[model samples]
Target: MRVRLASTDDSPAVAEIYAPYVQTTVISFETTPPDAGQMAERIAATMPAHPWLLAEEAGTVLGYAYAHPFASRAAYAWSAETSVYVRPDRHRRGVGRSLYEVLLRLLAAQGYREAFAGVTLPNAASVALHEGMGFAAVGTYRRVGFKHGSWHDVGWWQRGLGGQGAPAAVRTVTDLEPSELARLLALPGERR
Candidate 1:
């Protein structure tokens, strides 16, 4: 597999990949899956501020991962909330890992100090993925969201990104050098 930056044109594939989770599972609380147009808008809005990476092989997108500011407050600028979604058929194939490896590196390079991920309770696959990626258990929000006829808990995980020190201003994805971004996506961890 190979990891690369995600573009607006990849929205249809992204929407397709996320649809199952929305329609059939409580993994995502969204009741209605966004179509290609809405997905494109999401990419356009978030990519300007954070990295959105896609993992593919032989021109087929296997998965994608991305990050956005953890919160709008100034103090939260150095922290990001992250998410990843894979083609259901691509599970256990390292596609999610590849996408995350690139996404985390890009976030750190852009000055993020931490990354956070939230998994719906009882999702062993997602918990395993987050732990395997070096995130530690923080705390769980009990009965946080009501969806699919029940209230579901969400477990949050955290991983430090940049070095310990006062963080400089975070840079947007558009500010990153193309060569640097390309180099990060080529990391060994991003290669299957």
Candidate 2:
């Protein structure tokens, strides 16, 4: 498996990977699954600023991960909310972890100071994934959302990116040197 920058061309596969969770489980709070067009728009909007990554194996997308603005406030610029979604048929194959490892590194490289993730309650796999990735359980928002005909709690986890001293303005992914970016991204084997 290899991790690479996700493009709008990858949207259909990404959307396909995400739709089942939205349709059948409380793992995602979305009531309706976005189509490929919407997913493409999301990738276009998020990039330059944040990273969207996919893990591909044998020319197929096994999973994806990304980071987005944690809040609307200007003061929240240094923090990011992260998420990962793997194909349901390919869970526990290290695909999600491969995607996240690259996503987090790229976020830090872009000057992000911290990363946060929210897991809907009772998802041992998600909670374990975040904790295994060095995130600490910060707190939980009890009964925060109603989905699947029941109330659900969201547990937030945080990971510090080791940013220190005086702050510098964050750079977009587009601002990085192409060669370096390509080098950092070529992981778990080859680049696509």
TM-score of each: 0.95, 0.96
Q: Which regions of candidate 1 fall more than 4 Å away from where they truly are?
A: 189-192
TM-score of 1: 0.95
Residue-level lDDT for 148 in candidate 2: 81
TM-score of 2: 0.96
Compose the digit string of candidate 1's lDDT tens values, residues 73-127: 8899899999999988889988888778888888888889999999999999889
For model 2 the local lDDT of residue 165 reads 79
List of clashing residue pairs for candidate 1:
none
| Global lDDT of model 1 | 0.88
Global CA lDDT of candidate 2, please? 0.90
Query: Candidate 2: where is the Cα deviation over 4 Å?
Result: 188-192
Question: Cα lDDT of all candidates, in order?
Answer: 0.88, 0.90
lDDT of 2 by residue, 52-133 (tens): 9998889999989988999989999999999999988899988877788888888888899999999999999999899999
Best by TM-score: 2
Residue 76's lDDT within candidate 1 is: 91
